[model samples]
Target: MTLATLALTWRHLPAAPPCPRPRVRTSEAVLLSVATLALLLGISQTTTWGWVDPRTLGLFAVGGLAMAGWVWLTLRHDEPLIDLRSAFRGAAAAPNITALLAGAGMYMGLTLLMVLVQVDTPSGWGLGQPVAVAGLMLVPYSAMSVLGSRISLWVGARISPGRVLPIGCALYLASTVQLALGHDHVWQALLSMALAGLGSGSTFATLPVLLVRAVPAGETSSALAFNQVLRYIGFSVGSAVGVTVLGLVSGPVPDEHGFVAAMAVNAGVWVLAIGVVVRAIAAR
Candidate 1:
């Protein structure tokens, strides 16, 4: 779902021109497109990846290795299928930090959410959803990123998306806290999910707007793609942190309290992001 948002956001980004009749005729886009297809093929062929147990932690390691390969390859390209150079600390911290922090924080916070609902029967607060059903809960939120894209466009047509992004981030944080407070039924989950989606959706939409403002024209595509890569990295890290937190906590009946603890850790990200934006505006 988040993958879809990342794609949509990248699509909406103010793009750079294709190199004028490049000598090699192989640009970063072509390389990345091939890589994406390869990744998709790997995912689609997982069932056939036999010998290795599908449910084992080894799958996780395999996935990580795939990503590492992607990153490594991206860096190796002479023109870089996705430029890492632009992501340096050169620009104002607002865009740079906001992109990095939000990327990681969003992943971590969202990962925390899945566990909040999926903890075993012993955990009192869970919805006890099987893996499939639990996965479906995210469908609505996934749909919302498209909504976020629209919201960003509308907002961008007026004031800066920089202003809009913080607003979105705050709403997301509030949603996290509210969900932490607890839900008696699926509706609460739905509501919280919507709010959460709206917030994340908004950020996903707006960040590129912010990125374009902060980066130079030549580096736009690579910068934007890298921004997205950071987000994927964030999701992995966030999921891991959430799982780790669950292991350390008390058994069963994991309630609003558990979610809150996770949020407490995530809240620092928002604080740091807000500081970046604040300082950026102050410098302006």
Candidate 2:
């Protein structure tokens, strides 16, 4: 796949139009990288090291400081890694914030679904399915997401892309609620995945469109890249937090309550995302 991509790009990609070279913001880049890595590391290790451990606290502090430095430098620099001023404007900020929360919710749902099925039935909440079956359960999610993406395009054309966001978030919220309420039956799990996929598909597809429309043409790529970064950060944090919550609630084997708690958290995040997007649209 990598070679094919390379070959395709080499053969078919167009040359860039001549333009002045953009200056590299090396310090800002380094600070941003350090901040993201440190925060992710701190979150992931909290399950092993205990939240109060010196190492965990140190990482958190380092991440916070690095983030603060990055922001300060970005504000002062003529050509920073990211344009904080423009990015923070209502138009761009809404989609970015939505992406972060939606990403977290998406990962949390996936993790919980995978874990829920493989857990032994003896736990009184799991499906006791084999790993293969557990894996297959995600098929609906993948398939429905494609459909959802199409649906978002259709709906966006009729209404507006910004409005489409809340609809997607609402679907995700419903899926989480459904999963939280019932996951005992295999069909229930499958249904939840379907809904989640649809929601994710629509939400993810809409975010980029909204972001690009929000930013200047020259800054479009950078803005989109930053949104992706936030999304992945949310993914990392969500997966880690889901696992930690499960472990805390159900020990080595996850139980129904753990899944419920995780889903509840996921649902809460979606609710917040919906609110943010709606408010942004209203303000616009």
Backbone steric clashes in candidate 2, count: 0
Local accuracy of candidate 2 as per-residue lDDT tens digits, 200-227 = 9999999998988888788888899999
- Give one digit per residue, the lDDT tens place, for model 1 in 167-238: 777767776667667655666667767777788888778877878877777667667776775566555555
- For all predicted structures, in order, the TM-scores are 0.68, 0.91
Off by over 4 Å in 2: 1-14, 121-123, 249-253
Clashing pairs in 2: none
lDDT of 2 at 167: 95
What TM-score number comes out for model 1? 0.68
Global local distance difference test of model 2:
0.89
lDDT of 1 at 226: 69
